[model samples]
Target: MISLVILSFTVKKNYTSASTNSFTKTINTIVIDAGHGFRCENGCRHGSTGENITEDQVSYEVSKRIVAELKKKYPSVKIIESRPTPFFVENRARAEFANKNKGDLFVSIHCNFVPKIRDVRREGTRTETKYVYVGKGKKRKKVKKTITVPVYKTYYLPNPAHGTETYVFAAHKTDDKEEIIMENGDIFENEKDDSTINNNINDPLIKQQVALWTKQFFANSVKLASMMEEEFTTLGRFSRGVKQRQKGIWVLQATAMPSILIELGFLSNSEEEAYLLSEPGQQQMAESIVKAISRYKELVEKGAPQPPVNNGKR
Candidate 1:
């Protein structure tokens, strides 16, 4: 951390990763996004079908309950959900709303499921019957007999994967995300050129500064995500480890704040689907997330050291 601070002042402007924000901003408002509220026809579409539930439904339910829990636990903290109902909400719209409201943190709630496989692998015993003639005594005659034989089969099957995962933006998408932060909504174009926002694209100083801030914010997002995984693991859920996804998910990258996307569990798994739809399971997950946020707030607000970089490509 000390070395990082030294590099911020002494390093060349083109060296983007070394510099960092001079101050640690406290999180006062958090924007919660429920994944897959909209269909492709409506604008935003991100979801998977489960055995008994849908991603859009589960995400909205979980997000609504999490908001309830957050309100109960942190009365002073302002909480906003990108979608309170199952209405269509575009990803860009969600990001724009959070940015317009000056949200400090963005949390996207979603459910993960292995897509049902059309090329399914199968294995089972097949029934076989054979007719044979056997007689001993005075006369031999064809007799009716049924016999069962063991058989085997092999084929493809639907994936039954289940787990919990957390994600931050990937590094390869840094430039695109930086552009979003720079030009999306209040990021640029409309923002008046000041010491913070610079119109001169050639001047690498402010660009570097913004880059450093986003890098550190990415670091903080990892910290919070790790804490969340730990909390979920403690609750006896399978921890798929924190992930870095570059494709498909856009809201996290566009927002001008530290962000994370939580994959609660696989809806494709029957047991997990039932659990996620239950009152008890939803309450527990919401509480665990709130606890993780509380811990993150305590540590980050106290100016903890920047977490070591562990960005991944996938």
Candidate 2:
């Protein structure tokens, strides 16, 4: 199991300035993370697979198309990919890349999966021979008897669950979010100077600032996630809506920006797997993501208050 490191900090003063302080009016850099990667020889880190298709394969393809579409639509925006190849990258490394690049937004693409359901049926009956005692203890005798038993065959069928959902960092994991912000304070700094937040992390005032900034990041993450799910719904795809995992996702909370992880569809479902593996399906998914980002960019740059996120159901 993956472990999260949580840090404790005390806030003495209410830093209202942190709330008003905006990271940037315009989003200049966006990070695209293709979830999972090829399995190693040690039989670890392999992502979900079904119908001979792997989650890494689908995510990588979709991420590449998203990059292409975003570049075409918004030429000025800089795009960085966490995994440009199929090789496995640690969660820490992916977050580090986004932080080092000073990404304004982070999007991680992935396919969902559930275990196959077991299906059992009685095929036919067969004859079996067994030994049985025919009498009492002293006079007991072993006898061979023939009996018929039902034969059952078990097989696995694809799971029926299919849909798209978006995930932001769980609200309860704000401490982890604050820790990430403090560690990469430079990314959130408005000005490049000697008095950066990193220099005074131990100060109560600095801790308060980090806490407020984390709140802002969380709100923005929810807004972006809702928008992505809306786009998916518009395409007539089943939208599972925006969600927060009780167990924190490392890459989502560790990135020092508005971040989201998208579950495109379930690979264990044969129909959805076929759709995800098709050319047009990949293009459609990529276009929907780009459209959402375009709208999010406009809203943030205009300094407009984001619309309240609803349940995101159609």
Candidate 3:
């Protein structure tokens, strides 16, 4: 029998920047973005299968659960949701909401899409245009796993890759945490060894500390990603590894908090698409996220920032 092994560690409470208590610094405001609406309606497709699923619908389902879980724990915490219903919202509006509210962290949830390229007979000019769409058919059938064969100028746009991803906005300049990690080793030398310190990618003490913090962030993210992937996998979800992207996503850049985007799976994957559109799949996805967030809070309380969670078990 195959066993799923999940590694978790308790993190010590982290003090805020002002040297206040960990509880004081911990972010109390969270902005949950359910992604932008695809202007074209009737819902998006599940790849070439013609199974229809709306982007707005998926976002709402995932965000609702995240909000519910957060509210349960952080009752006093402020929660701002971009869209609670199946409505069209723009990217700019999403960014502005987080900014105006002074939200500490902004997490924008979205599904990935890869369009197909096809020929267009516009104005008698037979030029190629990139336009791929998913549509619903009269009846639903089992999803097929095969490549589409195109003739003539029927360019096949690659399918959108799925799996989970967490992105942090690129830093324009050094952050305060990075600056501190650079100036001092005496403060943390007792907790971490020289080889461990030297192994830091940036090597700068300040950068190292930031790296350590980010690593901790990724650690928590991975746990959540794993949980989601596992549940989704059994239900036919894709297994995209948890990765960090430094590009500036509007939500990631606008918030003052450390945030990442979790791409649950691709709508283009026939098998995964069907699973995601189902009710059971959405619940599992939400539960995975809640577990990850709860675990992160627990880690922060334990002060286990640098190394992987070293619990007694493997």
Candidate 4:
């Protein structure tokens, strides 16, 4: 089991002629969000045994590991844990904490599952892949061979489609001023952005900077995800690739900072569930998180060398 302890640190800042207090350097605070709670029941089960692994327990365990890792490596940085224990945090509270702290980043951890398909793939221009949950004592489907893209990194979760993934949304580019035609054919202004937010995307320079930063954040997340996979692999877990999701998710949408929700592995997988609940597995995950954060800090200070330049149209 990992420990959560909060510490304080100060930043140095120089004062300008007119300012009484000026911060010379910015001290970043990271908000670690562990999704779901132990008390809530979602009908979710462990993959390998079809046993129950409550969301609270999983998130709590993962969060504890993550916090411990961050503190060990980034002692100067402030870490505000959203869920310290199993009973106190919820999605709304998590968002509120970030907002209150003005967090530099937010990360929510989770696990994934495929209850429908066991493990099947189909070839396409690239390749189509599907994940199926294989229950205990259930020999469901034959492995289908096709040219589809592998859903996960092979280092950790080797069976296929069982591994870690990260994601970010493509920038919203629909013209803000454009009128929306209702069913009656009446035009109404789109209100996603009012006048204040409009200026952000309207400025070409601002848009470029935002896009660049967001991309960099995504790359950083991928690096962390890869590191975690390696750590898990060393401890004998599946390695899923750092993935991108175009669709909006709750944590992604709510986070004020660029964020990623990692589906570490499926509790639905019996073997995975047992491992995740084990002390060694948890420690491996924690160590991976620490390593990833260390790498991320380096990239942030020096800049990601291979930053994705794509405008996200693809």
lDDT values for all models: 0.74, 0.81, 0.52, 0.52
Ranking by TM-score: 2, 1, 4, 3
User: What is the overall TM-score of model 4 with all chains considered together?
Assistant: 0.57
**Ten-residue region with minimum lDDT total, candidate 4:** 1-10
Which candidate tops lDDT?
2
The C-alpha stretches of model 3 lying farther than 4 A from their native spots are 1-24, 38-50, 116-160, 171-237, 244-247, 302-314
Instruction: Report the C-alpha lDDT of model 4 over 1-314, residue by residue, as the tens digit.
Output: 00000000010011112222211113267777777664446554322222567545676787888887788777888888887776645566776676456565677777676553444443334576555545456666546455555453223333334555555433341111011101101111132212223333344443433334344444554555566566667666566656655454655555445466766677667677676777787677767766665665565545212322344531
- Runs of candidate 2 with Cα error greater than 4 angstroms are 1-24, 39-45, 188-196, 304-314
lDDT of 1 at 115: 62
Task: Compare the candidates by TM-score and give the number of the best one.
Answer: 2
lDDT of 1 by residue, 2-96 (tens): 22222233323335455344435466788889887656575654588777778888888888888988888878888998777787687888988
Q: Spell out the clash pairs found in candidate 1.
A: 120-156, 120-157, 121-155, 121-156, 121-157, 122-155
Better of 1 and 3 by lDDT: 1
Q: What is the lDDT of residue 76 in candidate 3?
A: 77
The TM-scores, one per candidate, come to 0.73, 0.82, 0.53, 0.57
The clash number for model 2 is 0
